[model samples]
Target: MHGPSPRRPPMRAGSLRDGMTSRRDRMNHVVLTGDRPTGPLHLGHYFGSLANRVRLQDTYEMYVLIADYQVITDRDLPGSIQRNITELLLDYLAVGIDPAKVIVFQHSAIPELNQLLLPFLSLVSVAELSRNPTVKDEIAHSSQQAVSGLMYTYPVHQAADILFCKGTLVPVGRDQLPHVEVTRLVARRFNERYGEVFPLPEAMMGEQPLLKGLDGGKMSKSRGNAIALSATEDETAALIRKARTDSERLITFDETNRPEVANLLTLAGLCLGRAPRDIADEIGYGGAAALKRLVTEAVNEFLRPIRKRRAEHTEGDVRRILAEGNERARERAVITLGEVRDAMGF
Candidate 1:
């Protein structure tokens, strides 16, 4: 017989500060993650980092940054960036990230973070910056004929974002590993030169499944193939209906032979919390048309509540939330920057 139902762990009685020597001495790790406010977040972003952020918020001292400054590396439209920043804030709240638990702020609002970037630039060489594969890949895809200095040095700015908060953990995909590496390198170099001021941040790599666009390419707003989180239920249905699928009579999980059908199945599996093969097996006899219909319905159902919640918030509400978060973030950044300045004799 099964052993008596497993008992839950007993709760500790004393205050955390009483048990610990200092509030800072308590060893909870800080996590830093973010998105550039270039456009509205979508399902691709949700699976990539948003869902993971929700899971990790309670366990870690979470800092969610909206990289408004980083958005200018390619875009010059201030109005568009401003609009997207508000949208990103609403999206974060709609996805269940409690403001009380998570520190969400605009990247540009933290002036100290930008101040920390100055010294970090000197610690890293131009050659090393040029060697970052993520930067190189981005340059190749970017429409700009020549890369800007800001684009080349943005990784160092990212290092400041991590070190400014003494972040120990960063959640990122494989493609973003290079940026995190730069942050680690900058941290080590600064510590060696001055003193041990910043924690060496490590990558918390997750199984970030990249979702494809309806056109079977990478999901992107610029490409006009993405199904945005802000999309209405009818809009989501129409987008999925037009998604590319092969002429296969039976559903199968053959990425090589049936990528389009496989993509649809992957989407359904992610939304429904089942394996792609399991989804394929269930829909095996239904054919491609039936499979598409199933995916469309599932996606709409999943987004219904999220869309409704997003609609409830106004622009003014987002601004108020952001103003409060910026004040809180500045206080934390000030403490870290003070430590860094003292270490460097600034």
Candidate 2:
């Protein structure tokens, strides 16, 4: 069911390449980035996008959305969503995503946001939606025997998520490039047909866009291959111990031939801020056990401060943060919806 990886396209707007002398110059760029509260975030989440968000919050008008409404697209229950949202907030704060600089809100909080979906749904064809590789990949991997209506129109809902807030930049992995493209198309079409209301959002990628799972596949919480940010020190060490590595005694960072080992190396490299190959050379002939030990140490040390900050937060704090962010998001959504309505003569 896995499809060929798509080539990463150049950013259509908000190219960080443009020289901006001051923070004031960067303030005009708006960034929409977030995660589904399906489970707690993992190291892959850290290196892939969360890390970039931490860095981007200072420069851009950042909106970190917890896509709670999208949880129902593939699942039947919403029981754990509340818990997952709390965990996500804790992870965000621990990783230096300042609530003051970034608006972290849930999907269902802003009614006006969802109101944009109806108009956006009209902007794209069913064929275009079906052609989205990210949606197709999700459908192919989903547990549901039949794709739900919500799952089919997931990209359009995402378009609402981005356009409702006038998001000009979206931080995404390569797999998600298509979804951002869908948002761009929706914005372009809405502006062209109606008036210039939405900005064509661009996709921003991190140095490490996709991190492999411990088993050398996609890193996912459901698959039990990811080490959650909430994981205790012992839990992280145990997970790293069980990470799949080849029998070759010499450790090397060859992503093509030795992906499992290379994944572990990548984890360690990301944690220690060093080249994976250099780490490999240092641990040459040490085999998988030594490599795992190094990774375990690096990961635990890196997460020590983050996990400590995470534990210091109470559920009430998370709720309050969400409430404030939801209010902010609603204010923005109301303005955008008014513009859309005026353009459509609604």
Candidate 3:
């Protein structure tokens, strides 16, 4: 049941190794997810996670983070860290994630997340942190001699993100399973080293498969294969035209044989709530050009409402909403910090 599955940790279970039983079943439900605010949310993000966030908002005390601190690990500029906050909010609003029910907050505003980072860093050895491939990959890619301290301890910031809210579930993709494990280890180690102040958050893996970019690679901004939610209809159509489909005159959707066409089909499927194969069948013998046309239409139609809503969210209003949400988040966070200080005689 295991491979290089990244030393995965499940909530309510890690204490088994430490011989400390937890009453996790009796606790109230809290869920957390969001972005680093380095850029806008693309279809990959929307298809992969945003819609489900709307549903989760109803069932959980949802807390969405604009992880500004995490962006410095990869980002080159500091200005985007500040501007992307409003851009991220618009993306969230465009995707139908209701801010009323959810706490839309930023990492910088909640100083408790950074404060929690200190004790958490002490709980785990550097050897344990080095074992995480994410950090290793980051260090390998960095322009610096050694990675920045934030890059090295990104997982701890994430651990702080989840535990500060005492969040029990983090909705994420498969690539992020390791980060969740790091968070779980951090939580368990903190509790073992200190007191049981935070719950170990489980990774509530999303049902949606990873959507591919037009270039037939995993969807990412760095790769230039993503379809940004903020893109115009003409822009999407033009991008689809350049999508790296096979030379097969007739369009077919087999991810193994034709990943480019499959990517387009998958995008259409997510928008229409149909299986990719079904969309593939519908486009049978229609030719790659026709498939591209169909996909462009679907994506443009899907984004119509989103773009409209985004336009309505003026910069000032976006700031006001984030400011209000940040205040609410800080209120909850400061309360948690006060308890931690009291518990530790700080």
Candidate 2 residue-wise lDDT, 159-188, digit = tens: 899988888778776677788888888888
**Best candidate (score: TM-score):** 2
* TM-score for each predicted model, relative to the true structure: 0.87, 0.91, 0.86
Encode model 1's per-residue lDDT on 1-346: one tens digit a residue. Answer: 1101111111111121223133354357787888888778888777766666776687779888988898867544444888889889888877767778888899889999998998899999999999899888777766566678988898998898887778877776557778888998888899999988887776654353567888998777667788888898788888888899877688899888888888888888777767889989988878878898889887777776777777778899888888988898899999988988898998
Rank order (by lDDT, best first): 2, 1, 3
Over 4 Å off in model 2, which ranges? Answer: 1-27
**Global lDDT of each model?**
0.78, 0.82, 0.74
Tell how far residue 268 is off in model 3, in angstroms: 1.5
For residues 1-346, what per-residue lDDT tens digits would candidate 3 score against the true structure? Answer: 1111111122221222333334455246688898877677788776555655665677679999988877777645555566778888888887677778888888888888789888778777778787788777667655555566677688877888888888877777556668888888887776776677777777664466678778887677656788888899888899888887776776666878787788888788767667788887887888788788888988887788778877777788778778888999898888888777776778
- The number of the candidate with the highest lDDT is 2
